[model samples]
Target: MTATLHTAPVTIPDTTDQRVVRRRLGPGHRIRFSFWFGPALALAIWSIGSATGLIKPAILSAPWDVVVAFQDQWVNHDLLGNIVASLQRSLVGLTLGVVTGAVLAVISGLSRFGESLIDGPIQIKRSVPTLAIIPLFIAWFGIGEEMKVITIALISLVPIYIHTHNGLRGIDGKYAELAETIGINHGEFIRHVVLPGALPGFLLGMRFAVTSSLLGLVVVEHYNAVAGIGYMITLAEQYGQTDVIVVGLVIYGIFGYCADSAVRFTGRRVLAWRQTLEG
Candidate 1:
């Protein structure tokens, strides 16, 4: 018998036909374009109107004039200094608000008695307008940086506290029972399960808190602050410098967007596993 050489058929995977998954644009990406595009289109229209003398240059400064004013402030380093001051106040307020709110949330979540003690006052405070409390804050802390930071923190606290409390309370009883069945201790359960379960709500609250804090910064700095964007806007208004005021407003908007983006980015990074599991 003649031995015939047998060759095994080789199977090739269709790499060429493999589908590529395109990542959908996230809210942040959409927002990035929306924020810049809307304002840019508006500025273009305004520029056209100003050039045609349809709008008064004095009342609505031309885009070029605004650009010139921005450059002037940049060259003088006044804008940078104001930005730093505003950022400092916002960061300080955010730190205080997040820590206090999270601590209160944990306490209130774990104990009905603690919730009863603090929930009523927090609810009452929430009903009151944050801007309305600025005078009291100033009176209590004096017209200083502390007053501004405190006001921002106070404004930021309510949303975070509410969301965190709700998140913790929303934890399913089944999860706890399952943990118990698995012989998980309270500490391990909280660290591995409770925190992960509550993360989405907490992160949502953080986003809200950060944005609120930035907005509150404007109101807080409006009073007796000599170095913030709000103070710069006030001064600009006094001199009928509409361009400068507009610039300050735009800067604040940018800052708010940046802060919101940061919270969202952090949430995505920290909760990546949770998101994957959910999906």
Candidate 2:
């Protein structure tokens, strides 16, 4: 008789939920290219659509027509000057909004009394659309650069304040206790503990603020302006220049994309210690 050895049966654990599904395309799949991928694909599609006569130039101009419009705007219409004007407004408004928001957020987040005073009006303002306030702004500040800049500043500040304030409040109470136990002064505690804790939120808010700056600039420029791409877009609309309108749209998109990218780049540098999927 042959001796038989009994072996224990091994069971495989379920990994369906745990497994990461990698795709040929996804957010995780970084397309490392110098050329803008989405715009290139869109341009190709637009060219094809226009060539096929599926898209009307009256509605959406052909890619080539847009290129020609861009050249014309650059050569004859002072595109660079318009861009500079828009950028100046965006930068100034963004600076004021960001600084004010940070200061207010710190004050409100630190003290209950400060929060009581600052938070209510800000929350109320947040509920009311900034665009809706334009008429009131015009009535008060009039149709000038002041109104435009203020409009941009007002639109940009709320988001940063909300985000930064949340960040500050979200800091673990244990850290405060730890700092107190270590006998750290209030100023030192704030600089070392509070600022770092709230930085990610501030940066996050900055991204939105940057976008809002552009949006506010566009709104004011469109409403009442003699310069800027928004003004150019307004003129294009009045003249029914579809190609020129497309050019303006492309410029706005580029400006927004570039600004957002700059913020993200800065965020990555500042928040290098943070472990996130974004990295």
Which candidate gets the maximum TM-score versus the true structure?
2
lDDT of 1 by residue, 100-210 (tens): 998898888878999999888989999998889888787788999888888889888988899998898999999999998999999999988877777787888898898
Segments in model 2 whose C-alpha atoms lie over 4 Å from true places: 1-35
lDDT of model 1, residue 241: 89
TM-score of every candidate: 0.81, 0.86
Q: For candidate 2, what is the lDDT? A: 0.89
Range of the 10 consecutive residues with the lowest summed lDDT in candidate 1: 19-28
Cα-based lDDT for every prediction: 0.83, 0.89
For candidate 1, what is the TM-score?
0.81
Candidate 1, residue 1: lDDT: 100
